[model samples]
Structure formats: structure tokens, C-alpha cells
Target: MRTAKRPLQSQASEAQKQAALRYILDAWEEALHDGIEPEMLANAALFAALADLIDLYGEDAVAKMTTGLSRRIHHGEFTLRRTAQ
Candidate 1:
């Protein structure tokens, strides 16, 4: 029974994550339509994300997690556009 429950729980967790992302993206789009500059929005988004993560997981843990972000960014993990090299 425990093993069976794990799949259901994982699916629910994934669904929740998707829903949360949609909500955040919708709010971000609305903010942009309301005249918020993209750079300002990006800064505020990073601050909010880091602050909430630190609050939930502590400063040291969040700092460690963020240390990999530079490598991820360089690898284009967050890139929306790709062109032929």
C-alpha cells in the first residue's frame, strides 16, 4: 500500500507544481501589462524567490542551491530561444 501511495502522491505534487507555475506566470504577465519594466520585474522576481526560499529552507541551504544557478544559466537551462551555432 505504501508503494502504491507514492505514485499518487508524486503525481499530485507534480500537478501542484505546474499549477503554481501557471499562477506565477499569469501574475507576471499581468504585471507587465500594467507597465512594469522587464528588468525591474526580473529583479523583483529573483528577490522574492530567494527570500521565500531562504525563509523556507534557511539562508545557507538556499545559498548553496543558488551556487549552481550560474552553471545552469550558462548552459541555457533558462533560455527560451535557441539559434543555430
Candidate 2:
């Protein structure tokens, strides 16, 4: 019998999201330790590091990270969010 796959958002919670964000930050720190370029860090390098973390940590972790990013966006913590007038 086959089981249905749960969507990432459905599987993630606030705490899990925070943990994933922490993991991403840690990965960024590690990349800095290896002397990755700043511009690269802002682009593909950051994503690469995040992908490595997700590979090591699992899909759930990535989903949580996505959730955390979304929360930040919703709260206007991310630059893309619009400020209240």
C-alpha cells in the first residue's frame, strides 16, 4: 500500500521553522570560515549551503526553513514585506 505525502507547510511548525533558520545561519557561518565570497554567499553559495544542510538534516528541516522564511515575510521582517502606513 502507498501512503500519501504530506505537504511541507503541513509538516512544519513554528519551533521547527526557527530551528531550520538557525541551521541555515550556522551553515552561512561555516561558509564564511571557508572564505566563500560575500557576493556568492548572498546568492548561490548560501543556497548551496542551505541545500547541504537539508540533505544532511532531511526534507522536514527544509520545510521548516521555508516556514520560518514565510513567517518572517508575513511579519515584515524580510525586506520583501510591505510596511504598515
The TM-score leader among the candidates is: 1
What is candidate 1's lDDT per residue for 8-78, written digit by digit as tens? 12334778988987898899899999999989989999999877766656666666678899999999988
Model 2 stretches with alpha carbons more than 4 Å out: 1-10, 45-76, 79-85
Q: What would the TM-scores of all predictions be? A: 0.75, 0.44
Q: Write the per-residue lDDT of candidate 2 for residues 1-85, one digit (tens) a residue.
A: 2222333344578899889878877987899899997588788855776676566556666656666776786676756335687
Q: For candidate 1, give the lDDT.
A: 0.74
Model 2 TM-score, 2 decimals: 0.44
Q: What is the C-alpha lDDT of each candidate?
A: 0.74, 0.67
RMSD of 1: 7.9
Q: In model 2, what are the clashing residue pairs, if there are any?
A: none
| TM-score computed on alpha carbons, candidate 1 | 0.75
Clashing pairs in 1: none
